[model samples]
Target: MTHLLYGDRLHLRPCQIDDLDFLHKLWNDPDIRRFLFDDRIISREEAQSFVDLSIKSFKSGYGLWLFFERQSDLVAGFAGLLDFSQEAPSLIFGTNPLLWGRDYATEAASVVLRYAFDTLKRDRVIADVDEPNAASIRVLEKLGMSPARRTIVNERPLLYYEIRDRVGN
Candidate 1:
């Protein structure tokens, strides 16, 4: 399991089978659902299947990690890298509503971006945010990612943002 630290407010760890309930609850939230996964309501079985798939994928160094609030030790949400294409890998993040506006997403994403660039030694990281998700756009900007392209995914228009690690200062 990989553990990522982000100051004293939040940390990220691997998502375990025990986290299924939390994932179900979070995914059921209308607001949260609207911004992700095509605003669709998912069944428990679907959630389980997703977790199972992610667990398998994690073995290959690509999958989501559970976000946690350090003080409360609660699952805040999830963040990780996704294989968007063989040539371009993207970073993705989702935080519990209770932690929204708290910078948890930004903090965790910053750590993930650093890991992608430093540990994974990736040259760049990209993100596809729904056009209506202004807050996420702000977070991307704050992470130093700029708009790279815009495309439609699953019938939804998405803005693609990217950040590249410069070789030398």
Candidate 2:
């Protein structure tokens, strides 16, 4: 697997074809899907398609990753930059419900944010969190991102957070 970024407790790597099973398990978790799109359970075929599409997107330097625990190498969840547009992008991240409340999301997101600004040289990055998802809001704030705007996604109100590259100071 291709390692994208690593933190003290987690390492983010590209999702491999063999990761379908793990991805399926993560996506199907009830709590994991709670803040996501309607708690939809995706089929194996859908999971495969998602992985394939993500792989294709990775080639262009935009896609999600299979977040792994650095100590045990257990698949925790997915995290990375999602391409919202050529000029605008969003930070994508989530963890298995079992791993919730452990700060893994914050750790992984912090590393990716550094990669976005320092490595990719992106001017800014944004994240849309469901208004009621307190955990997600905390993660964004922990990474130095501040509320930028509010918008509706899929008929649900969402809060957008943003962080920009700080080249000096």
Candidate 3:
């Protein structure tokens, strides 16, 4: 069950229970969790639940997927269009801290965005970034996602960005 989303340097695949350890390690990294989990530590139980949910995303024909560098075979990170049980799906993305500043997020994001629009037939996709995550904001903007609004998410200020399918298809 190798689900692959190929990019120039990434091999995006469906995440599985076996990936809990990797998810735990990456999700707990201080640098990544700072912006990702709102600076809160995710217990193993929580990470397990998260993986379970991602696994379930397959039923909907869309969900989070883990990706690796095509040639290097190194874990690039996870990126996905999570419905998050909301009215509209949101873009969730990340890369290994060691790979930061390499446009991997931007590249992975673009791949997911196309999947959302072209394959999933979504008219738009959105991302919610913590106010202080300037880097994440930049990546969303680089993908042509515009700031849609701001609000209190999880008791913290967050900037919500949105990218609509230009052709209205």
TM-scores of all models?
0.89, 0.90, 0.94
Worst 10 residues of 3 by lDDT: 1-10
- Please give the RMSD to the true structure for each candidate, in Å: 2.1, 2.1, 1.5
lDDT of 3 by residue, 77-149 (tens): 8999877646678999998999998898888889888877887788989888999999999999999999989
* C-alpha RMSD between model 2 and the true structure: 2.1
Considering every candidate listed, which one attains the maximal TM-score? Answer: 3
- Show pairs that collide, candidate 1: none
Model 3: lDDT to the true structure: 0.86
Ordered list by lDDT, greatest first? 3, 2, 1
Position 131, candidate 3: lDDT: 94
Error of 2 at 94 (Å): 0.8
TM-score of candidate 1 to 2 decimals? 0.89
lDDT of each: 0.81, 0.83, 0.86
lDDT of 2: 0.83
Q: In order, how many clashes per candidate? A: 0, 0, 0
